[model samples]
Target: MFGGVSGKGRTGPVLAVLAAAGGLVVFGPAGGSADAAAPCAGRPVKAVGFGAGELRLYKGNGYACAVTAAKNPGTRRRMSVTIQARGSAPAGDSGAYTQLAGPVTVHAGSRCVRATGAIAGGGSAQTGWVC
Candidate 1:
């Protein structure tokens, strides 16, 4: 399982195929300042969600990152991003993607990546799922 979205049961390759079919490209570094944007820096892929907020995905340098933006729903919410090599679980001896608090960026050096916005009140939404 990829952590948050359990029903998809989809693999990394499938997600990557979907992303590519959607016109998204693999990202890489562009020489400049460290602050300079990567190839996929500003572009974000939208994910499935509950329609309460906005979720975006960014991929670069073999890592995938996510950002979530929501209106005032009066609840504490945070975004999570995770990634793993193709056909690998989020947890195992293979080492899973490092989880990070978002809209901050994270290094998901895996073949596939997933993101979700979790509310402190026990509600959550999938932000992005891609390879």
Candidate 2:
């Protein structure tokens, strides 16, 4: 399983994490510098960059997860992340955040998956389709 979030941030930033046992772990705007790491299990398979951040995808054990991490994290800003398995509705998270957006996930048992993310309303999309 993947460990704690890791991205740009201040030293000794606050953190909150849950066990990545096929579940979602969300951290709110924490104190001091707004930087944290990406939280998810599995090996990274694909990533798409944006103006201010990036969308990363991971896969393992027939499951996949996605994350949107900001390149610069300090001020409160808009962020969003989405992941969708083919034939299923997409899952996403968006709001004013200091650091990152989501670790949106899906069960991709032999199916293709698409992920999208944005920081400050600017971002990119990916059709990994890593079947």
Candidate 3:
């Protein structure tokens, strides 16, 4: 007889429809959510201009104070620069640290410093300066 399509077979389509509806409920557009971007968006100023000719260090108000130099020919050096954070200084100083390869010299009255080394893959020399 038609005993093959008896108990469980008749409910298969219903179960499938329920499963599909459940899936829709779980994965619907209304249930989806988006992620927000981080508070710190742009590249850190210290991470820019590595292996270049010179680098400039600025205070919170964008006042330039120091410069970094590129690595000397046939020489390897690690250079680092630190700019104190605005109003966060231990003794009322605020700036940032931009590092580059060196032989770095901060000349008097100069607006940039030099790092004497090859630029690493991270877009900065290994001066160990923290922004």
Candidate 4:
């Protein structure tokens, strides 16, 4: 059964799917600077506790990136993630999208970010990131 309410004050439909599937699932709003197109940066992703999850990120101006996790090959358990970046992106391609990653454990009374991998194209990869 679902145990807690998210930052949004309710368990969304996506979470319900995870609970029914009997595996860990993580999700959160796409993080980054505020730009007109920034909202398209990433789409929500889902994964089974043991299988790999695929995260699709959309960059402004039609560029996009996909982040995938290698199979855990370990015990199935609850997973959490946190997504962060150096700064926000500008209105156009001139803006820079910094580090983005998460899939870490959620601490007591805290939520996980849930993003993982590099910013998008050829940038430094973030640490403790998961999707």
- Model 4 scores worst on lDDT over the 10 consecutive residues at 88-97
TM-scores across all candidates?
0.40, 0.67, 0.20, 0.19
Clashes of each: 0, 4, 26, 13
TM-score of 3: 0.20
lDDT tens digits by residue: candidate 1, 40-60: 364455554444454456776
The TM-score of predicted model 1 comes to 0.40
Q: Whole-model lDDT, candidate 1?
A: 0.48
Q: Return the top candidate by lDDT.
A: 2
Order of the predicted models by TM-score, top scorer first: 2, 1, 3, 4
lDDT of 4 by residue, 32-117 (tens): 63553333344333332222333323322222233323233243323222333223221112122222122222221222233343
Model 3 global lDDT (CA atoms, 0 to 1): 0.36
Ranking by lDDT: 2, 1, 3, 4
Give one digit per residue, the lDDT tens place, for model 2 in 1-131.
22454666722332323333223424545535323444767778887887888788888788889988888888788888888888988899988988878888788887888888888766555646666
lDDT of all predictions:
0.48, 0.75, 0.36, 0.32
Better of 1 and 3 by TM-score: 1
Candidate 1 backbone collisions, by pair = none
Instruction: Give the per-residue lDDT digits (tens) of candidate 3, residues 1-131.
Output: 23345575587766677788889988876632322311122222443345443444332232323334443333343443333323333111112224332221222232322222333322343323333
* Candidate 4 global CA lDDT score: 0.32
